[model samples]
Target chain A: MLSVHRNHPWQAFDKLMRNSMNLGRDLDRMFLNPLTRQRDSFAGWPQFNLWTNDDEIIVTAEVPGLEADQIDVDINNNQLTVSATVEAPELAEGESYQRRERFSGSFERTLRLPFAVDQEKSEARYVDGVLEIRLSKPERDKPRKLSVKAG
Target chain B: MNNSTDLKTTNPPSHELQKQESPTPEGAEPTRETRLYRPHVDILDSADKVTLRVNLPGVNEERTDLTLEKNILTIRGHIDPPHYEGFELVYGEYGVGDFERSFQLTNEIDREGIQASVRNGILTVELPKVKQASKQKITVAAG
Candidate 1:
């Protein structure tokens, strides 16, 4: 006759060890992952949104504390590049920084357009720290209306 | 009787002296008020020019201040904080910190043509490039 239930001490110990190791791994990933990752030069790139309208493609980027002249916009070979250098904040004389969170440096972002753009017709405007770029799509890529005969 | 006399000779309440030195506004009832602080910031290039943006939440465009002194740019503004009397805040989360940020300009910025504007909660500063620093076309002479 076999016992209805059996208690295994080794099984309980093994489960406890597995749970402890899993917790340790989770903590290591949470704390060390970001510190060990390699960051790009343009790590603090501003958030931007790109969308297309009927005849133009619009790109909006959040570039706080930057002037219009500080930014350079170049379009070449169907790609648009936006580059700018932001100077770091100056510390006061004999003042030691306690906590610094703001980021400052040169950054560049290149975006490829879905359709070829008319480089000459592109326009950029900066308002309220937001940069808006409007690029007119090439004439051939624009949608054309076709006439249909009613049968 | 001697103990009571010694207690009276002790230092007067400090609150009384403060009240006398700075009297409250005449006919203005004291009300608890809160104010939000938002810092102004500027972005500039290697040249010492000012490019500023002020984050002024719940503040009108007319109430903000933007100033530039030599190579330093300062932005100052105020926002009305929330008001809730007799309400205990449980699990409160949102509050705005006062804003005060300054930037030192470099020599390349054109200080004369700095432009600024504020709309919504964002302030934008435009620092024009100096004429000599801009890329210019060099003409070739025929040999």
Candidate 2:
């Protein structure tokens, strides 16, 4: 998508405000939300993309500094879930950060697929901090082109 | 073709501002310059070294560039826009573009000893601290 760049300070401020609001919710989740107090919050770290075609659904997530082993993708009954933990890098002795903006912790993202998928035909690959997963549509869910005979 | 060996850099957009913004006496100058997004970075100051963790998603090792000149460090990289032949985008929130950011280095860093590596879209730069940068212990002599 193409976006027009505008030199408006208020726009940036608006984005900042929105980010702070998200941070407030994150803080709440970090401090207040226990396991029982389940808030249906969709906010999570590392942005992603989801697309679909007639044959399959694909998901791509940008998660830098993570290995493939650290991520877990699961699908069941048209629901897809991705869970991962990004451990903070160990600091050497006397090490301190002037600024630490990158987030580190566990996150779980659950998505509802548009159609049922064949679990056995799915695959995932991780490269250069991008994780791409392909889930093939089930045979029953595939759209069929019917043949018509005219007399 | 999804080749694992081929290095991938995120797509570079043609929309980057061509000229730096400057003041014009007659108010004839363009109102805006190129928009540059600041990449998130972590600067760790340690006794032995200072490390930087920069997030440059979609940028590969081959497309990344790190330079240190006159106590200033700069990082630049390009990312190719993703294209799937048959798929239509259903949902998206992240924007794609090239990444560029620079940092002024302090005197504590050893200019010759800096090292950088890019892995899994994270650029790690280690700047070893000079001997004098470390905290010095002073000895007191009783007179």
Candidate 3:
């Protein structure tokens, strides 16, 4: 029994090491795979996060360098869409540019809410380049106190 | 294909301004110039807090500075332009502008515990809620 107990830990360790090696090999294969490489060539799409509370759902999208007026927010049929364009800044004459990494031009993103939202009560705000939208959920979906009766 | 070539051939207004701003050679009159630099930023809400990621390439963490004044969070950094003294730039597309961006913080942010970090040219700022703002419970007793 003592031998079996000792061997159990060793077996677990061996399995963990094998899994680690497999993961490393898989990563290498992914990097070398042609389809994966081609997909990576495209510029990364913008990223966003959504949070839901008892009464509302809030969405925040990372879209730097765009003006609040340039951004458009629309909600229809339970779908929300945010779109904007970042125009290049005016440059000084004769100043040759060495590198330009900032992404300019148009971007659009659409999100679907798990629960239906009350469009009439929704609010949107943009400050310091971050666009935030708060969508109130329907009254029926909100939590309520239910009375209980003793049998 | 046609549009791509057209873009390649014509300089954007910003690029044209940059070229006109270059120092004139001896005996040539200096040209009047105006320059503008704007950094784009977007903020998205996460499960527990708001996550702000700023795209600031060529900006080192050491050179970047962040400050919150009057609810506005300002980020500033200087980037060194590419240097090649002798080689002529040919068919260039990228331009590096000085980085400056600011965001107004709301009451939801936990001012005391806001966190920031930079990795791979991206700056991520995590704005958490204060304890009071995140609280959801209240209790009452029958008289």
Candidate 4:
């Protein structure tokens, strides 16, 4: 006998719930955050990526044409914020832009982690225009293995 | 085909920033092929020269390759993906990969005079326009 494909009802319910939540967010953005041409262009500058290990969480952002001193990184507990403003390039007296696509403006983005981090022990590095922040998980937040006694 | 080679971009409509596909493997182990991305660029035109400014974060001078094959100019930058020991990626807004972009040069461009430089992850290339031969000013006094 051919195995019948099982269709779980929960999966459909989960999808429906997610779709409604997303629709709510879309409505909220349309009403609360008015979409402007300027906002659409640079609102999402410097995309980010996050990684986690047993003891630390790593956050990285691509900030091209910026140095370590140009960008700011701040962390409080489980919240991390990265902000920067790109200076506009100067043009010569007779020169003008034929095609401009790069972004130049100030933007700040904040992220909340699953657990709090140790701010004092955290480290940040800027290399090749990429910013990386390693936030160490606090002692109480890290997982601890409890060995079972032999019976 | 998920050949463990090709990559795709995460952001759907971000045309200004670098666009590359993950092609990032599930783990830290290296994949058989490297992912390629196209960096954003600004073109500046002047009376004598045109300048191209390319955004190439995480790229250095040594890892960049600029070539002009006939009229096609190619810019390639190789970068090592950000990796942390024993860490798993939790969130990703962008992918890391090599940057590759190409532009076509016209006959008016002086290919021999073209020059490029990379600094602070930005690459600038200047292409000079070939000078036109001087026009003769004919005198009609004696004619």
Q: List the lowest-lDDT window of 10 residues for candidate 1 chain B.
A: B13-22
Instruction: Give candidate 2 regions above 4 Å deviation.
Output: A1-42, A147-151, B1-36, B133-143
1 against 4, candidate with superior TM-score: 4
- Per residue, candidate 4 scores C-alpha lDDT tens digits across B1-143 of 54212111111234545455533335655443667777877787777888999888889899899999999998988988866878999998888888888889988899889998887788989999887653356778975
Per-model CA lDDT versus the true structure: 0.53, 0.71, 0.57, 0.74
The global Cα lDDT (0 to 1) of model 2 is 0.71
CA lDDT for candidate 3: 0.57
lDDT of candidate 1 vs native? Answer: 0.53
Report the poorest 10 consecutive residues by lDDT, candidate 4 chain A: A32-41
Ranking by lDDT: 4, 2, 3, 1
Please list the Cα RMSD from the true structure of every candidate, rounded to 1 decimal place: 27.1, 14.1, 28.7, 16.7
Candidate 1, A48-126: lDDT as tens digits: 4566655667776656556677889998747888987644344333322222223345568787766678888899987
Docking class of 1: incorrect
Q: Between prediction 2 and prediction 4, which has the larger lDDT?
A: 4
lDDT of 3 by residue, A1-151 (tens): 5676586867767878999977754543433232322211112334455666556677765455565677888888468888776553333232222223344555576777756888888988764444567788778777889999899
TM-score per model over all chains = 0.40, 0.69, 0.39, 0.71
Q: Return the candidate ranking by TM-score, descending.
A: 4, 2, 1, 3
Off by over 4 Å in 3: A1-44, A143-151, B4-143
True contacts kept of 4: 0.68
Q: After superposition, how far is residue A49 of candidate 2 from its true place, in Å?
A: 0.9
Model 4 C-alpha lDDT per residue in residues A35-112, reported as the tens digit of each score: 321222245677889999778888988777777788788888889988887654656656665555676556788898
Q: State which docking tier applies to candidate 4.
A: acceptable
**Chain A TM-score relative to the true structure, per candidate:** 0.64, 0.67, 0.60, 0.65
DockQ of 3: 0.02
